[model samples]
Target chain A: MNDLMIKASDVGKAFGDRQALDGVSIAVPRGTVLGLLGHNGAGKTTLVNVLTTMLPPDRGTAEVAGFDVVREAHQVRSRIGLTGQFAAVDEGLSGLDNLVLIARLLGASTREARARAAELLELFDLVDAAKRPSRTYSGGMRRRLDLAASLVGHPEVIFLDEPTTGLDPAARLGLWEVVERLVTDGTTVLLTTQYLDEADRLADSITVLAQGRVVATGTSAELKAQVGQRSVTVTLADRSDLPKAQEALERAGLHPVPAADTLTAPVTSSRELAVVVRALDEVGLEATELALGEPTLDDVYLTLAAHAA
Target chain B: MTTTLTAPRTRWRGTDVFTQVLVLTQRSLRTLVSDPRMIVFSVLQPLVMLTLFSQIFASIANTPGFPTGVSYIDFLMPAILVNTAIQSALQAGVGLVTDMKNGVLARFRSLPIRVGSVLVARSLSDLVRTAAQLVLMMLFAIVIFGFSPAGGVGGVLAALALSLAVGWGLGWVFLAIASWLRNAELMQTVGFLAMFPLMFASSAYVPVGALPGWLQAVANVNPLTYAVDAARALCLAHPVTGVVSALTISAALGLVGWVFAVRGFRRPL
Candidate 1:
């Protein structure tokens, strides 16, 4: 029963001749967030759509909440919730009305629908905007309402497809906090996003996809190790020694980042620093500014995308 | 089908279908109620056409093969009643195009709702709105134009049923149109343009045989002609058999439209 909240085996989808997802397999452990990191058209939405039963996969099988997506799609749907990128609240209806409407559609009784809507509105910081038409709400507020609508059924599993692409930083953080609270309550989340920092902050595990296949999947630290580059930046004692610094770095199999004017080259270890310094001294090079740093998630994303392509 | 007892594949209970329909209906209704300009256009424009055409053809009873001495308002009332419903159904496609553009339809598709809820709920909303249109036409005919049914209560009911059927028929047709068109703004332009000429050129506002040669040939194929002719037969005089045939025709048109709508929606967007 604890196999996973979501399990897919060789799930593939295509539009006529063009493949969208190619034999992709992923497992999202229960009560944890698994981030699907991909650029647009990387088959993120296609995977979500297939799992939610909106589009059937051309090949392969997926299950959500222990129910097969194709055979028990409705049961899967009932157990899971989705918050699409766009705010899908009925813009014509008030915020409260929008939540209550979906709640009722999920088969809640009238009193329960109203109480649930009220609680959700307060939880999302939308109590003030509850009576106003959703068409008039701000983008962040609308996104909150959209996420709140997804919670109407008390789903065990939730899918958030780029929930914060077009929001201000504060709004994005607010949504992040709500997601954090949801996870603390043991909700399993499958989040797909283009933002590397978002995945870094929220995901328990990450799967990086590119060009229709999973290129890398691991803990953030583990995936970072795959494209091994931690940089140590150094400024020269004399600008003339820049010529000598270039040779020392090349001999160590380290390359400088293009925009760094001083010196930024890959470092194997802090112990190896003595070897580099000695090599630099022999080559007549010295530094004034020096520090070592691991690669950022952005660098990892780009390298993975480029490698897959 | 070995899974009948296997805990219904969908969390969707049959009763939830009604709630879904109601929610969708309320959303559609609220949008319309909020938009005063649209409400006015939907209600008033039909009434204007009803009066203008009736007054213009007040003396049409003098023509051979037409009912002599029947009031033009009475002759026009039933057909106009049906016309108002059919027009609303036909134009209901615009809302679908709007939903498609705004991603409302796609969101519903992704959710755990019943299959066909979106389309069925939209048509059901159209049905209610068209019924309101029917009441407005009835009020105008009775109070302002001094028109009442000479065929009595049964005739009025048959008239209502006929229009509702026609409205549902064209509603299905518009559903197909909305599904096929990618850009909704373009669809609105095309839908409105298509409706005006088709409504005005047919026996809806004037007898089709009275039109110029080219349009008369065109009206021969227009389905609205059959609907209006059926209503005229029901309200103004006795040709019960003709009314029966028109009902059959309306059913056939509705079936064909449903086929198109299903074909259009069964495939992925």
Candidate 2:
């Protein structure tokens, strides 16, 4: 309990007739990342707002860094930093001035604030643009500056709400690397992302939300396992060979479903690909193409949605 | 980068509210100064008013029942300052709405600083900005328009201070409106609607007695009338009763605005 940096129990929130969050709960331990995976309108931002003390829950409670969000909001605020969905830097101020302002507001002396600003500017590779107003920065630069501003206080826990939502692939990768570095430095993180690959890459555990409820929660591997097997598909050279191929695969203890000139069979792992090839070769059946498919976060969502309905 | 990550955490003693307000005020002031165009436009509107009103209404001072032996510019100077204060105060709400739309206010909310600091800093910075605009207008009046007040420099300072007090009080009103509306365009529309009627109906442009019966009744009850009349008294060395009335009204207005603004600000976005 003491090691958990973020803990929320049965948190619920509603706006008018709409339930933005309903009985959602999650816990993230110290120095680990909790990936909140959800689509739009899935209560991702609402929960972030609650845990960050920007909004109180309609029911239940939450705690961050050992402080209750509602009762000890100031304590929670002091221990956490939030980079909201939108980049929240002062566009009118220079990048350096923006960072220095945060540091000063957190009670740093003039020299100390400047020093921290300079350090963050160098770290985020904004040294060249330090004196330019943040509005002049590119999208990637602005997001970086926003993240750097949140880090000015050296917060114990960081909430990044879709930190790379609009970035190109290269920029997304750059931000991912930054998050990875922060995790390495022993900071706890709660990241909300619509991208499964992002969650798979960053989160120690993933919580999937749909329609303001937690539809699933587990390690990425565990969630993938729940969605079931990887599949192998083989396209035959001739339609006549399909029956023989199916028979061969069946004898090899594989279930192959055939359609037209193709046979697709679910397999536990990639190693089963060799089994299909060897079995088909024994019957002199040639294949034009062979492919393997891994169950993705999309499959998990579809499966969950199907189950819910 | 590693050094910063590994740097020992500073003990989380809370920041003094005064320091927080000062720092946030500095941020607002810095943003204002960096935008030369904004400063230019803010001053230009009132300068145009000063020019147009002093020229067009210069003859009214010689009319029946009007105060004699003083140029219309002197009479109009204090009123213009009051009007300028009103315009500048409207920006307080507009600025807050801009911050809300741009997400800076959201970031500020997530920080550990006292929530009231944001509102206080907003009004304080706008007051400083209003002071700058008023001083420039005063200099323009003295140098360009050959305007001289009978109450001398001390009275001029008192008038300027009174205008600022009115602006500060009104600043909170707009801030409260911004907090409730949370839409910059809507806030501007509402601010203009409230401001125009108050400005025109007051004694700022013409003596309340010279107005139609209905408008004079409205002007008599309008807070701006008291503010403008009080500022005019300070400028021309009239009785102190209007000044006392204006200050008390402003203080009451400030108290009410502060309560509602804080409540509205605390509402979840």
Best by TM-score: 2
Q: What C-alpha RMSD does candidate 1 show over the true interface residues after superposing them?
A: 7.8
lDDT score, residue A109, model 1?
A: 74
Off by over 4 Å in 1: A229-298, A305-309, B1-16, B30-37, B55-66, B152-157, B212-221, B266-269
User: Superposing all C-alpha atoms, what RMSD in Å does each candidate have to the true structure?
Assistant: 6.7, 6.4
Give a tens-digit lDDT track for model 1, residues A31-148: 8999998889889999988888878888999999899998988788777778888887778888998888776777777787797788788778889989998899988888888888
> What is the number of backbone collisions in each predicted candidate, taken in the order shown?
1, 0
State which docking tier applies to candidate 2.
Answer: acceptable
Please give, for residues A233-300, the per-residue lDDT of candidate 2 as tens digits.
89988888899998999899876777667887767778999999999999998789998877665556
Worst 10 residues of 1 chain B by lDDT: B1-10
> Which stretches in model 2 have alpha-carbon errors above 4 Å?
A229-296, B1-13
- In candidate 1 the C-alpha lDDT for residue A23 amounts to 94
DockQ of each: 0.22, 0.41
Evaluated at residue B65, the lDDT of candidate 2 is 72
Top candidate by lDDT: 2
Residue B71 of model 2 has an lDDT of 84
